[model samples]
Target chain A: MKIRELLTRWVGFVALGIRRTALRATHTARQRIRFSGLGVAVAIALLVMVTGLSVGLATSTTVYDDDIDYWIVPDSESPESPLVATDSPQFSSVHETNDRITAIDGVESSTPVLAQVLRVGTNESDEYVLIIGVINSPALEDVSGLNTDSLTPHDPYYGDGEYNGTWTGDAVLSEGTAELLAVTTNDSVTIAGNRSFTVTDIESQSSDVGNVPTALVQLSELQHVTGATTYDQADQFVVSTSSPAVRDDLEGIYPQSSVQSRGEMTASSTRNSDMALALAATALTVALVIGTLFVVTTSGLELVADRQQLAVLSAMGISVGSQIRLVGAQTLVLTGLGGIVGAVCGIGGIRLINAVAVRTITTEPIAVVSPWFVPYGTGVGLFVGLLSLPFLVVVTRRVTGGKLG
Target chain B: MAGSVASFDEASSSVVVSATDVTKRYTRGTEPGVLGRLLGRQSPPTVCAVDSASLEVRTEEIVGLAGPSGSGKSTLLHLLAGLERPTDGTVTFRGTDLASLSRRERTRHRLEHIGIVFQQFHLLDSLSARANVALPLVETGVGKRERRRRATDLLERVGLGDRITHRPRELSGGEQQRVAIARALITDPELVIADEPTGELDTEAGRTVLQEFERVAENRAVVLASHDRETLELCDRLLRLRDGSVVDQSPPGGSQ
Candidate 1:
């Protein structure tokens, strides 16, 4: 007779669903559903981890300074498929070649850079840092987002082209390095096999280098200490120039190397970034497929074993439509709960992976988690649950046979 | 047979369910495909599970179906309860033809009018005794408080008040059957069809369960299918079925 009463009567199926689903599963049925959910959680957690890593690789391909316009990297492989190798081709006579490039028109500055994961503290402690070798010049003020002008500049350690030069031992530590060693500016710390360097500045690194433990040291000093002074070997060279014609000269400096201007670098990086996202999407699809199949098999077996209970329900005058509603409600509850748990687990996993990468590689993160990853992972879980509905329908039909005893 | 047949025309408002010339036939084996038949495979045989048998059950009467295993007693009861359709003839509940209704309509018709009890109990392992009793009313859209209160009271009436929270696995065979009976009666259905209610119980448990059924029959008509001799002694009238046919019908304590 009343609007509210009519509305309540129309929504009676909701009451039926709540009363029959996992919220009121029998002890035995609950055990079955919980195991199914745990399996989905593990699959979803793995998907989240792989996707996070893929995103990290895409967004964090750079370890050079934010302002560097060109990079001369060894072109041993195609630039499109560049792989970060621990040991690779380098430029001999990099200092002289960089000096020539610096003389060209529109060239503001040029510097040779060498990056190695070398131990920083004493042998008793195990702390490795990304020791970057660069010429600290006023014209080029930053390397990997840390102030480099505080360090000694220009050939101070390459006196007479011999190993007997005055070593300033002045180093600029990234914020992460300062916190790792518990040191401040003006404090002396052991590095590169017990050679003590005074901390000149501790600057917070830019987003380009991520949260790596980094330090900027003079180029020739790093080369002399690391026994790489034979050909002035460096990993790569960063050049600052405004003229597009300057790239051709930089390319000719090393015939076997390749030059990537700012625009070209961003395009290549974008391609790599797109590939990474594609990889993450594939992993997510795989996780969802595996999760769906597992739930179907397990839930099918459970329904087969509990057919008699379904028979009982059918005999009690409950319609097949009502039974379906109850089963669908149960599946949603199980997967929804698993998704929440898996997202939480995935968040923890991302942090753990990033921490390990920082400790070992110390330059670029291997995985990064975003705020949206939680809801995304949960959505994946629900999608997996929805995928298993056809199997569930078949099982429901088989159990609720036409003839009731 | 004394007091065996009731005239169909004599049926009135007191008649809850009447099966006239009802028969149920089931195929015995799977049919061979054409290739199998070419290889000398035989055709599947058909077995008549229930012959053309007429019966009228009035409200408040305890009608017992007595037969040995594999007889038509259970099949006849199934037809009367609208649990299965008859191969021939008509089964009408409260003057409505059950065969005319769709599967969903038939189910609803059964739900609103009839209660059923199985030999194996068929209790849900996940639900407690009280929840099992309250299950049928959930589809009826009864309020939670009312369902709980009614289920609790019914469990107490069935002598399972203390076992209300216990799951079916935790209860004894007689206790579980009593819970099932309580589940059936919870909706206050007009007709109760019980198939071998004591088939899985011991002598003592069976007697206790039979006593509960006796009390259940006080409020509704009971069509009980069982082979046990003493179970039939509690019935007002007995129908003896042999080889899918009702051979004779008589009052209890009389020769079949």
Candidate 2:
């Protein structure tokens, strides 16, 4: 019975503390509520935006929008690294490996990709553009931000290692590259100032690849131009498969190559690059430090100002534990309110970051807001409130030490 | 003057609280710092707030602690109310030593058996007069409906039924004190301690509060510290203090 009574009293105290805190918050909305809440909200907003930007930059290495499940890159290179211009020893037999990978049960299709930076120019100026050579397959037809239909009627004979067999001087340009070169469909451009190719189509800027200037040509043409015809060499293979078992098969195809699933590729790339994580951690630390300072100082001052009221409660036999809980509840209510406002501000921050990035750096957004960040931001706010608890307890104890006056 | 008073009806009334030779001392200034210690400095001076005071408060009596400013009346009242432990003596409430109880246990004892009122009428500014009355009951785990009903009844009894919804700032000083009295009596404690409860009120308002105190003192013991003669006249007995010691103890109608 005694235990039950104690538990009941505790429940009553918590409920009363919550109600009183909320009432006091609303009553003193101007002096108490707005001061701490707005400070915390701004901090959380900046943290959320920083986190979004970090995650976006970390995941931005996925340049292919096609539903390719795995990227087979040379072990000496990374998928997230800027396209490797030089061929590795493993790059020599990629075409033969691609053919073998297509025979796997779960492997729906495979294509060898050769990526190189070439200086393509107009009569007025010239600029370096990334050129990717891919086989004309159904997988390429469905790629986002790429118009491969214009390359159709040109069959899939590029991997045959004979550039003169079925030559079509057809090439596609990314909208960004097209704009940079001031070229349109049917406009002719010189590759390395030797080979001429017609721009068959212009694809828009893709979210996966951002605004990097890029061009696509037939694999055989790129091999012929890059002088890799001796070994049918390519940089990497893009494989589309629905089964996890295909990963093991792809990993064994070459001695000095790696097979990475989409998520694995993202994690691997992000893990190797510490700059983004450091930036995010720094942003989070700055935000938490600012928020903790604001809450502690404001709450400490408030407690000192309200010492007499706490003394009155103490005199009336209210327990010290209850008083501390009251302070905690008040802190949480303020920070929670701030969290809600911060979430809204964070969304706006994400948009502003994207807009600024498009103008200054990439043609796509530099930051993308994850839906989970809403709750993460709010939870962090609550954690900050909890962090302010020890300071509040010290203040309360000092103020209510057996003195009413 | 050095003796204690036990003036209530011996056969019918029982002691609710008793204090014996209670002395409370307070240091005057900050403690000596590291430089002072290195120079062999002495500690801060001390003053006796309450000195060797003895008293017994029985049920069915209104005991007034009367004195001038800094006469130790408030300190003595606090000692009797178990708000502070005496520096050199013991206080027992209902046969249990308050000094022996843990801080948590003492708080629980006060919550269950003692109610205190302050001179400043420390009602939460945000809570309504009714909610203020119900505040103690909330600690006792009373249901909301019952807490509200009892609070409303007390407010009506204190003649503030119409002001139940009013916050402390909206109410007059007397009304706030009445609300404090209602809050004190909400838990129906065995003893009620008030420190200059009427100090902030006018004569008319003070009288109304005194009348409510008289009503509340019919069964439980009441110990009020006040300098007002009008307030003391309503007490059954008065203990007047001077310079941290009790100088006189007598019935209000008798010579001190």
Candidate 3:
């Protein structure tokens, strides 16, 4: 009941404030309020857009396949954001590790992945394509967006851990690679100078981390061609599992590597967290400073101009506390409106960034927008209103000096 | 001069407001800052706006304060209504001394017990006539629907029902003052103080306001201050001031 009464009183005060603001006749006062709202809106928009960019950077992944539930990457590995890291610490004897992980209960399939940028093209032209070698299995669907149905399963090219097995010469090319090299599904392309492969399928897909030309091939074949065959080394292993408990087993399989679940794809879990967080923090601070300053400055000017009105209300027996509440309600209304507009502009900014990213070289979305941005922006706006109260209180007290009593 | 308060019938026992030997003095020069105060600067010249004024009115009495310009009519009204505390003496509203309370408490007491109509028709230009009339009710924590209902009814009573939605800037001077009167009466205050309420209006508007006051004065006690004799003629009792002191009064009382 007490809560209800407080809400009722606040509603009354807010109604009074809004009526005054909406029906006010002075053009300067209206312009002041409009500029304050614009300042808050622009600030919130920038904050939300910057946050979306940070989220996009954090969620970027090299393994684009949806079914891959976990990644076992070396703990010392660097930058997965934008996924252009050339070399990093590798997991040795990945075949042994993959076997151990696949034997775990609830495990669907485990494929050790090795990524290397290699020149793959016809004799006429060549393009440096990101080639990911994964041992395709009946349980796997795709790798780096390349469909794995046509690739030889189980990496038959590795005969008893030796390079003596038959080379399948089967490759799956992304549409980017197909376009870059001007090749089709039946075309042949040579890689690493002496090794050649037949393009069995062409899929229009970009690397999940960012847009890039890519191809998929059998693990051992590329290992032999790239000299990763020394210890059956691979950059990481992608696991498709039905149970989350398999993450613990994957973690224990390789002592030097860390198991990354899909849920851990945030800035904090990534190596580039400092940069992403800095960008986000800068955006927040700028919004805070700009928003708070605008609210205080505009409200002060407005209250000063309404000094006579304040005096009149004081004469009408309005206590200073009640007067503050009325003014506070007006500030909240102003900032709240600004927040809604800012959130909309921010969402549009995120979409624009994503669209431009797709049309240009960055084929994947580099910004993420969420529905919660509206409420968060409005919350910040309310905070700005609260912050402006001390200044407004001083001004009110000046105008309603003890002379009235 | 201090003991010259007029005596009337036994109706003083029911006095809604009583001012006894009230004096208000204002310093008219530059007040000393911290440095000047530290240097023992002399006090500025002072002007006594109200000096040893005494009067009282009972229920249903329409008391008038009449004097030429600068005769303290408005100052006495301000003191009586608790808008400004007297520098000396006491002002009691329904038996409680107003000068003994804090500024906020005094203001609250005025809000609850006294309603005032100013000479300038000080209605907020941003608010509609109905909203302006409901301004006092807002401070008293009245609900919006009820405030609106009461304000609209009061405006209708004042012949401004059609102008409820019109902003002050859109209303004529007489219509604005009428709205002010409705605002003053909305609180059902024990005493209504009008300081030259019709001073800014033309003869026609002033006559209309006087007629409204005649109707309003039927049940409630009013203390109206004006220099116009015609305006004061409507009062049941009259107090005349000269140089901030009440020199004469009518209705079988001597300078009450």
The DockQ assigned to candidate 3 is 0.44
Worst 10 residues of 1 chain B by lDDT: B1-10
Chain B TM-score in each of the candidates: 0.91, 0.92, 0.90
Best by TM-score: 2
Instruction: List, residue by residue over A106-221, the lDDT tens digit for candidate 2.
Output: 98767787777799887766878777777666555633246566765333445354545667878888887787789999999988788888999998855444334778887778
Ranked by TM-score, top first: 2, 3, 1
For model 3, the local distance difference test gives 0.81
lDDT of 2 by residue, B110-222 (tens): 88898888888989887889988998876777777888999999999999999999989899999999999999999999999999989999999999999999999978999
Clashing residue pairs, backbone N/CA/C < 3 A, model 2: none
- Cα error of candidate 3 at position B56, Å: 2.2
Error of 1 at A333 (Å): 1.9
Candidate 3 structure quality by residue, lDDT tens digits, A1-405: 266545656667778877666654243257767787888899899998998787666544456467878888777643332122245578777777777888899999889999888988797888887788898788888776677999978888886767787789998987767877888988899987779999999987643343456789999888888988887888888898899888888878766667887545443333356776778878888888889998888889888877877877888887887788888878888888888889889999988887887688554467766777889888887788888888898888888733421
Q: Of the pair 1 and 3, which is ahead by DockQ?
A: 3
Task: Give stretches of model 2 more than 4 Å off.
Answer: A1-25, A64-178, A184-269, A360-362, B1-13, B30-40, B127-167, B170-172, B202-208, B251-256
Per-candidate local distance difference test:
0.79, 0.79, 0.81
Stretches off by above 4 angstroms in model 1 are A1-26, A29-31, A61-172, A175-272, A355-365, A369-372, A402-405, B1-11, B31-42
Tens digits of per-residue lDDT, candidate 3, B64-150, equal 998889899888998998888899999998778998899989888878888888888888777889988887777776777899999
Candidate 1 clashes between residue pairs 3 or more apart in a chain or in different chains: A26-B126
Interface RMSD, all models, one decimal each?
Answer: 3.5, 2.0, 3.1
Worst 10 residues of 2 chain B by lDDT: B1-10
